[model samples]
Target: MHNDDLSRFFSENMAVDGELSFQQWEGKVLDFAQRVSRGNCKGLALVSSGGTSVPLEMNAVRFVTNFSTGSRGAGLVEDLVVREWACILLHSESAQLPFRRVMDNMDTERFFTELMAPEKSSAVASIVGTYSKYKTRLLLVPYRTVVDYLYLLRLITVAVCHRAECLRTMPMVLLAAAAVSDYFIPRTLLSEHKISSNDGMTVHFSCVPKVLNVLSDIWHTADCDVSRLFVTFKLETHDEMLETKALKNLTLYNCDLVVANKLQEYKERVVMYWRDTPGSPTVLQRPPNGSIESLIVDCILRRIECDATGGGRS
Candidate 1:
């Protein structure tokens, strides 16, 4: 694409809801990128979580959103952080947060009530240590709208892909688990103020372009010899179509792996479609009384470690 075409593509595709917040969040991302450059963090993982919203009006009295709760992605962040990987968690403001889910049950008032309980002591100490050790390593970059999510994702993804090639010695990973919106009311189509129900309504929205293609190309070139392991999730409501859609994404986006699961079985099992492996892919199952986090984390770490050692794509 020519320079003019490239510029026009972005402008017409994603229009921001709040320009100020987008710019402010971008500054934060730049600072994070600078920090990564100077740190000795062995690996860098950018994990996106939650669902994105589309504003119906400029003031946004009403909007559209997906059904994602962000549990899987947030869990992934916790697993990586616990293993000491430098993490950038780009999550929705309403989504689940790493460690906080556990701490939410360990409320401060409830804690003080049982302040000296021996059982609570261990759990309390663990939480304190996790926060203390990971405060500097795990950075949270939250988003509210689809526009904010896309803009921030582009900024961080491009920054990492561009910089990793030049200076990174450790492996980099991009895990996009967000259930992004495929349709949205463009800025030009949105009303300046909320529409009143007195008129009853019909709205026109446009398809939102996916940015995975750009990231894959940016990080895949021979000139950019950055070792990376990219993974994405595919959630399907239809059991029969799960594998088919996952396979399609695995090829279309050129991802290293795609975690495909039906909504009913999402928490219990995830079928992984491998890009490097030839025949069938692996199905990671949670035992009758097991934690799926361990299984998921183990699979990801195995792939990431392989690429890091193999010196490039694995």
Candidate 2:
């Protein structure tokens, strides 16, 4: 979008106070703004979950999708909420939720088959009940298409970027684990009707614009404040390519940290690379007594705490 268009876009979205999701999101941002203005609340986060789909037809019967169960993102939300952090969860419409699905099925490997057991009924009910009671703490916004995700992300990113009006500025963290599509057929070139299989068609693909540079530079709580921290995840199956791609992402996107994980061993291990740390990367192993998800949550929380204390330098 052009400069005027982007400015108008932000203005139009910032005016949306009646929408329930926007209201919930705005409430968290506004509260954090107030608290940070008084040096009270410290951490605020925006999390994106699930994979984005690229529609191949204007009618939208079929589409190309990316690979993601959204389990990691959902788990992050669950842990962050229980730790009393304000989070905005932007997830796919078809994705599993943190408390409702992830909590009910603690055995992530086996899926929800355990919940089908008669002995687990009460435990499941208790978790759902608790979520329903405190659901207001989470601002869940669902997006199906890639376009929808990008638009909503732009809106939320701009909305939370208010000027730090006091001595303290709240630490804003972006934990983007969503699997977005690499290429798609633009809407203008999409077929209006379904193509017949008898006539084989060769589809053309175009690159989807990566917005991390725009995010790091334009999306901020204040001008030249350096208060926002971005943490991105890199998944690769090729062992030789993992470190190169992860480090490339950090440099290319201008993010604060890049997590490199092999697709096969992601759940068991991950290496965290800090932007300012020039030497050894932190190698995190999943605890035998606990899960890797919990360990990651703790690491992120500690980083946020450090950022809040050091005026957003962590």
Candidate 3:
């Protein structure tokens, strides 16, 4: 991680008129630029998750996948590595760590014991045998809450921008797929203790900071640039009228492309909307009328490639 002082250094050196201080790190920046120009630039893929903690209601059914399984992101990450792209995988909760199928039925405590023994034990062997063989070529940066995700996002974005600029490389692309919580209660409900049957607790709600919009704002304001491509997702539940709502939300975010899907269509999402302008949309690609992860992956990758060519956004 870069030192906090470095941020101050960059801040203090800003141009008198408040523009980017291009000359602040003249010598160092030039050197880095030269190195990048020489084709030594490295590519990066950063995958992150948003915080998810559903508030409980007395005698109410709990929800699963409230945060994420990290399944789709992890799958794409595996594919990216196979294509030789250097990447980083950021996560929020570890409880939902995407486990291999073999571990699905294992006794976790016993498995760990074998993994730590001087020699490999049958328990460990069985666990390993059940696991799928795959290469992980990504830096792991895990965060547990929305604030953590925001902090890491800012730090990495700045560093990535510097590396890209110095090397004269294309702006780094960012994918916004995490199902971030829209709001967070200021106070914990647990501290409130048991509520009276006669008196109902009407908790006040406040909006949480929109991290994606913040990222876009920073990217737009900085002298540093980003990738020719930018992708974001909008998940909704109104299958009959999802496209319009998703497009409206995407426009508000100022993203290049929005991957919108309805909750009801997750099992067989045959309809989606792709819009460069809110008024005009194309039925880009539709999956078969059935459940399919590959279809979702393909659609997203295709849009990613489209933006890579600089066809969308400003």
The clash numbers for all candidates, in the given order, read: 0, 0, 2
lDDT tens digits, residue span 1-314, model 2? 34355445344432244334444555555554465445333456788999999877866787889968888788788777666666678899878787877464467644466546656567666777767754655677788777667667766676676433432345667888888888877666888887667987788988766776666665543453535778888899996698888878888878788878998998899888888872567889988877777788787777766665675533
> Across residues 26-79, which tens digit of lDDT does each residue of candidate 1 receive?
556657766765776767788999999988988889988975778888788877
Per-residue lDDT of candidate 3, residues 241-269 (tens digit): 67776766576766656666676654444
Model 2 residue 178 lDDT score: 88
**CA lDDT scores, all candidates in order:** 0.75, 0.70, 0.49
Best by lDDT: 1
Clashing pairs in 2: none
Choose 1 or 3, whichever is better by lDDT: 1
How does each model score on TM-score?
0.86, 0.79, 0.59
Order candidates by TM-score, high to low: 1, 2, 3
Q: Which pairs of residues have clashing backbones in candidate 1?
A: none
Over all chains combined, what TM-score does candidate 1 have? 0.86
- Where does the lowest 10-residue lDDT sum fall in candidate 3? 56-65
TM-score of 3: 0.59
